[model samples]
Target: KRSCTHRYCFAVCIKQDQRSRHARGTVPTSKERGVREEQIVKKIFATMVGSSSSWSTALVKISPYTFASIGIAISIGVSVLGAAWGIYITGSSLIGAAIKAPRITSKNLISVIFCEAVAIYGVIVAIILQTKLESVPSSRIYDPESLRAGYAIFASGIIVGFANLVCGLCVGIIGSSCALSDAQNSSLFVKILVIEIFGSALGLFGVIVGIIMSAQATWPSKG
Candidate 1:
C-alpha cells in the first residue's frame, strides 16, 4: 500500500506541472500560435498603411513657393535646352549649305532667329511666374488661395515651356530641310519659310493660353 500511494502521488504531481506549464503559455497550442501570428500581421499592416498615408499628407502640405520655383526653373531650363538643340542642328546645316550657296547665308539667318525666339518665350513666361510669387510665411503655407494660385502658375509654366520646346524642334528640323532644299533649288526657300512661320505660331498659342490661365491666380493678402 505504501508503494501504490507513492506512485499515485507522483502521477498527480506530473499532471499538475503539465497544467501549470500550459497556463503559463510555455506550451502553446497550434490555434494560439496562429492567433498570435495573425495579430502581429494585422499590426504590421496597419503600421504600413498609416505610414503611407502620412507620407502623402506630408507631400500635399509642402510650401507652394517650392512648386512655383520648380515651375519657373523648368520653363527656362527646358526652353533653353530646346533652343540650343534647334540652333545646333539648324546652324550645322546652314553652314554646310552656305559653303555651296553663299547667298543662302543671309536668308537662312531667319531660322536662327526663330530658335532664339523660343528662348524668349520661356523668359517671358518665367518673368510672369516670378511676378506671381508672394512671400508667404511658413505659418501660412497652407492657405488654400495661395495653393491654387501657385498651382496655376506652375501649370502655366509647364504649358509654355513644353510648347516652345516643341516649336523650336519643329522649326529647327524644317529649317535644316529648307537649307538643304534651298541649296538645291532657291525657289523652295519661300515655301519652306511659310511652314517655319506656322511652326513658330504654335509657341505663340501656348503663350496666349498660359497667360490666360494665370490671369486669375491672385493670392489672398494677409488680413
Candidate 2:
C-alpha cells in the first residue's frame, strides 16, 4: 500500500513540475521546443544591432527615413516611366506623320519633346523630396515619432507618381492623335497643342500637392 502511495505522489509531483515549467516558458535541458524555436532571434545579433527591448519584440524595426526615401525614389521612377511611355507614343506618331506630310516634321516634333518634359518634372520633385529627407546617424536608433512623416512622404510620392503617370499617358494619347491629325490638316495643330498643355498641367497638380506634404515632413537627424 505504501509503495502504491509513493508512486502516486511521484506522479503528482511530476505533473506539478510540468505545469510550473510551462508557466515559466522554460524547457528541460534535454528537450527542444521544435520548429518555432528555430526562428527565434539570436542574442548576439540582437545585442550588436541595438539596445532597445522593443526591437526584440517587433518583427521589423524599419527606419522612417527608409520610407521617405522609397517615396522619393517612387516619385522619380514612376514619373519617368510615364514620361518615357508618353514620349514613345508621341514620337511614334510623329515619325509616322512626318513620313506622310514632311511639312509637319519640324512643328509636330515639339509636341514629343513637350511630353518628355513631364519626366523631368518627376526628377525635380524627387530631388526636392530627397532634400527634405535627412539621414539618421548609424549609432542612433530610429524614432517612432518619425513614422508620421514617413507615411506622409510615402503617400505624397504615390500621389505624385500615379498622378504624373496618368497625366503623361493621357497627354501621350492626345499628342499622338494630335500629331496624326496635324499632319493631315495643319489647321488642327494649334487646337491640339492647347489640349496637350492642359494634359501637362495634370502633372503640375501632383507637384503642388507633393510639395505641400513634403514641406510638412521633417526627417529625424542624429543629435
Candidate 3:
C-alpha cells in the first residue's frame, strides 16, 4: 500500500507540471497574437488616411497638348494681329499723303506695300512653325520629355510673337512717316527707307530664334 501511494503521488506531480507548461505557453501566444492584431490596425488606418504617392503622381499630371495648341495659335494669331495693324497704319497714311502730292504716288505706294509685306512674313513664319509641330496623342498627358518640349515650343511661340509684334508696329510707323516725308521732299525717301529697313530687320530676329528653338521640339514619347 505504501508503494502504491508513492506511485500515485508521482503521477499527480507529473500531471500538474504538464498543465502548468500549457498555461505558460498559452499566455505568451496570446500576447503575440494581440501585438500582431495592433500592427494590422495601424497599417489599415495609415492606408485610410491619404498617402503621398497619389498626390505626388497627380502633381506631375498636366495637359501637354493644351499648351502646345496654344503655342501654335499664338504663333499664327499674334503675327496676324501685328501685320494687320501695320498695314492699316501705313495704308491710311499713304492714301492721305498721295492725295496731297499726286507726283509721289509711286513712292508712297511702295512704302504701304512694304508694310503689307510684314503680314506675309508673319504668315510664312506661322506656316513653318505649324509644320514643325506634331499632333499630341490623346492617350497620354504630360510625360517628362514631352513636358520639356512643350515648354520650349511655348517659349518659342511667345518670343516670336512679341518680337514680330513690336517690329511690325515700329516698321509701320516708319513706313507711314516715310510716305509723308517722301511726298514733302522726295530726297528724304532714301534716308527714311534705310530706317524702315532696320525696323523690318528686327522682326527677322524673332523668326531666326524661333526656328532654332523649335528645331528640337519633337513630341516626346518615352519620358
Q: Pick the candidate with the highest TM-score.
A: 1
Best by lDDT: 1
TM-score of each: 0.76, 0.69, 0.67
What is the C-alpha lDDT profile of model 1 across 99-211, one tens digit per residue?
Answer: 98998999988999999999999999899888988776666777888888888888888888898899889989989998999999999999999999998888899889988
Can you write out model 3's per-residue Cα lDDT over 1-223, one digit (the tens) per residue?
A: 9667655655665456457767888433666656755655555445555567777676457566556667777876787778778878888888888898877777666655665666666666667766766655665446666776676677777777777788778888888898888888999999999888888888788878877887767775533
TM-score of 2: 0.69
RMSD of each: 13.8, 12.4, 21.5
Query: What would the per-residue lDDT of candidate 2 be over residues 22-124, giving only the tens digit for each residue?
Result: 8999865644433323323343235446657776546246767777888988998999999888988988888887887988878877777777777888888
Q: How many residue pairs clash in each candidate?
A: 0, 0, 0
What's the residue-level lDDT of 96 in candidate 3? 89
Rank by TM-score, descending?
1, 2, 3
